[model samples]
Target: MKSFWCEQAWLPDGIASRVLVRADRGTITSVSTVDTIPLGCERLYGVVLPGFANAHSHAFHRALRGRTHSDGGTFWTWRDRMYAVAERLTPESYLHLARAVYAEMAIAGVTAVGEFHYLHNGGNEMGEALRQAAVDAGIRLTLLDACYLAGGIGQPVTGVQERFSDGTGERWAARVAELREDGNTRVGAAIHSVRAVPRETLSLVAGAFPDRPLHVHLSEQPAENEACLAAYGLTPTELLHEAGALTARTTAVHATHLSTKDIGLLGSAGTGACFCPTTEADLADGIGPARELRDAGSPLSLGSDQHAVIDPLLEARGLEHGERLRTGERGRFTPADLVAALTNHAAVGWPEAGRIEVGAPADLVAIGLDSVRTTGCAADQVVLAATASDVAVVVSGGKVVARNGVHETLGDVGKLLKAVV
Candidate 1:
């Protein structure tokens, strides 16, 4: 058993002061208000919020952070450069790189990550490397094994994209079935995009993991929409819907370019929309209809896709900021709404995580109230003002894995990232 006394904590109802949280094993057992500190209990100062869940990520993309910015290009052009990096990643090299990347996310207050993985390299070796990396970094992972059978609509796999293909959806499923999940890991499925997977195989990938989380790259680029429309005489969303891919357990990543009917189909199907605001802006992908998606019934989640940035707080902020820039309005999403999106563990298949209540995973992230970026901000509104630098302590599964941008076992994140990338 363990206990922690927080200066303030973000409870389900709202923020509370002098909060006491108790954990047994790796689950939070109780939460309450205590006037006095208890002996032997750890003290977490500042404002403790539920650990963040990164709903979409490509762990290997961390290597391309500063490399791609020197050139001007669209998402497709940036993707070509990304393929170069993907081509160089052996299982051994990827293990080292992914460990460092996951460690960076750990210090940034992400307790869980949904890796939108597609770099198969012929087998599950790369996926196994990722699972080990998450364990070493002290975080939970959902390896969303992707089915990438095509390079584009009506195109064959070429270049490094061949590494991501498993020949057929059945082969992809057979390989993924070998990936066993334990306490810290889960297995999920992903459609690389409407471009990467043919329409015939869409149902195979979506239905492959009927009981697990399914994520797909929706219309991230205008070109993708045009290509899908031209190829199928239907939008990508319509195709997915016709194939029975849209469902409650599905999440559409970067639904940036969507029709009114597309949004309605996704929301009415109870699907989730994961917005990668930083990546969208970095790749010049347009702002998505985040507010409209939520208003139409789809739950919203946030992701630091491509690792262009790794801060969940900043992702939440970017989500709202993108809304403001697009809608010309303030307070598009309330503070609570942003917090919910940041901590949406269910979107990644960990339904019992991302909250500080009993039965939830013992994940707590303390953000410094006195930091230069967060000073004078309201406790509830800190999601709007803070960054990863303000994270003082990150506790995942009842263990303190990181503090002050330093990992517990890995030491400084800079050195970890330097050693690999």
Candidate 2:
């Protein structure tokens, strides 16, 4: 059993003071809003918030950070370099890279992660090697094993993309079945995109994982939209709908170029939408319908996407930045909403996570209430002011991974990260 006594903690509804929280094994056992410190529990001061859930990520992409920025190109061109890096990763190298990257995320206060895993079929064991790497990294991974077939609408996977593709949806299913889930890792599916995947496989993938999380990249580029429209005679969202892919368990990533009906079907189908704001802006993917989707009551979450910037605090803030730019208003997104996106929206996208309420896993981040960022701020100010650097302590599953911004597993992540870049 472990207990945390804090001066302030962010409850689901709002911020409260003098909180004492207890955990047994991994789940929260007890929670109290009392000012008095407990007898034998560990005491930690400052502001405690729910551990941020990274809804989407590619762990290996952490290596390609600064290298991607120096080149000025579209997402397609950027992918070429990414593929070259992807080709060189062995299971051992991947584990080493992912361990260091997840440690970086822990330091930034991300308690759990949804790894959009696609690298598969190098060894005799296939992607089993890659899945094991995430388990060793100490972050809860949702392996979104992708069905990458075509290079584009008609082009076939040749060199590096061969690893991402199986013979067909049948082969993909056989491989997906090979993945065994553990407490820390859950296997999921991604349809890659209309460009890299066939439309027919959408049904095959989703139906196989009924009631499980299914994420797909939708209309991220104007070119992708035009191509899907030209080939399939519909936008990517409509094609998925026709193939019975969009459902309650599905999440449509970067629905940036959806039609009025596309957005309507998304909200009506109860599909979750994940907006990777930083990647969207960097790739010139254009402003997503953030306000529109929120108004339509679609569940919204955030993702680091390419690891261009791995900070969830900034990801939360970037969502607001996109909304503000579109609406010509500041404070467009409330602190409560952003916190939910960073925390509990993980629940909608990842049913296993999302909030800090009891019975939820004891994943949390503690920030200094008196830090320079929060010098004159209050509860809302905690989110408004704090950055990833201000995250002082990170606990995932009742185990302290980072304390005072120092990761216990990896020392000086920035210094190590530079080696790959």
Candidate 3:
């Protein structure tokens, strides 16, 4: 059992002051207002929000962060460099790299991550490495095992792409079934893209895991849409709809190049859209219709895809900043909306998390109100003004995992990343 007295807390209804939160076995048991501080309860100052959820991630892509920018390449060219990194990773090396990368996420106030994993070296060795990495980093993991069968719409796997293929969709399912979930891990499914998974196998991958979260890389570049249309006469969103892939449990990553019809189809099905604003900008991918997708009935979430930047606060700020730049208007999304997207654990299959109320996971992030970036900001609007550096303390599963940019169990995250990267 553990207890914390918060100076300010983001409750479901609104922000509250002098709140007491109690937890037992990693779940919140009660929350109430208190006039006096209690003994033995940890003190958490400033505004404590629910821990952020990174909805879409490619953990191995962390290796390509600063190395890919010098050439000033396009997304296709970037893929060539990314492939170079993927080919060299063994399960042993991946565990070291992913452990360090997840530690970086932990200090950024990320309590849970949806790793869009596709780099399966012909078996579950890589997936098991990721599961253990998250455990060592003291965070929850949803290993979104991806099915990659084709190099393109009609192209066959070549080079390092061969490692991602499972020969058939049934074979992919059989291997994914071997992945077991424990207390810190959940197993989910991902369709690598409409380009990699063919028209016939889309439904097979979609229905393979009937009760888990499903994600897909949707229309990140114009060339993908062009190839998809030229081959099947349907946009990526339309193709997924045809295959019965869009649903309340589905999240379409990088919905940047969608048509109005594509947006409508995804919205009507209650499918979620996860925008990696920093990655989209880093890869020269245009700003997605985040406002349009939200208004169209699709829920919105955020990610650090590729880790050009790993700060969830920056990702949330970039989300609004991108909207303003797109429409020439400010305040496109409210601070509350950005916070909601930041803590959208449901997008990653943890429906009971991302809240501070009773029965939810006791994951909390304490942001210092007096930090250099957050001084003089309103309590409710700090999401707009703060960065990950303002994170004073991070609590996941009712345990303090990080403090002041330093991981609790792993020591210095920078040195860990320096050793691996």
TM-score of each: 0.99, 0.95, 0.99
Worst 10 residues of 3 by lDDT: 64-73
Top-scoring candidate (lDDT) = 3
Tens digits of per-residue lDDT for model 2 on 76-104? 78889889988988776776677777777
Clashing pairs in 2: 343-354, 344-354
Q: Write the per-residue lDDT of candidate 3 for residues 248-297, one digit (tens) a residue.
A: 99999999998999999999999999999999999999999999999999
For candidate 2, the per-residue lDDT at 250 reads 81
TM-score of 1: 0.99
Q: How close is candidate 2 to the true structure, as a TM-score?
A: 0.95
lDDT agreement with native, every candidate: 0.94, 0.78, 0.95
Q: Write the per-residue lDDT of candidate 1 for residues 84-179, one digit (tens) a residue.
A: 999999999999999999999999999999999999999989999999999999999999999999988889998888899999999999999998
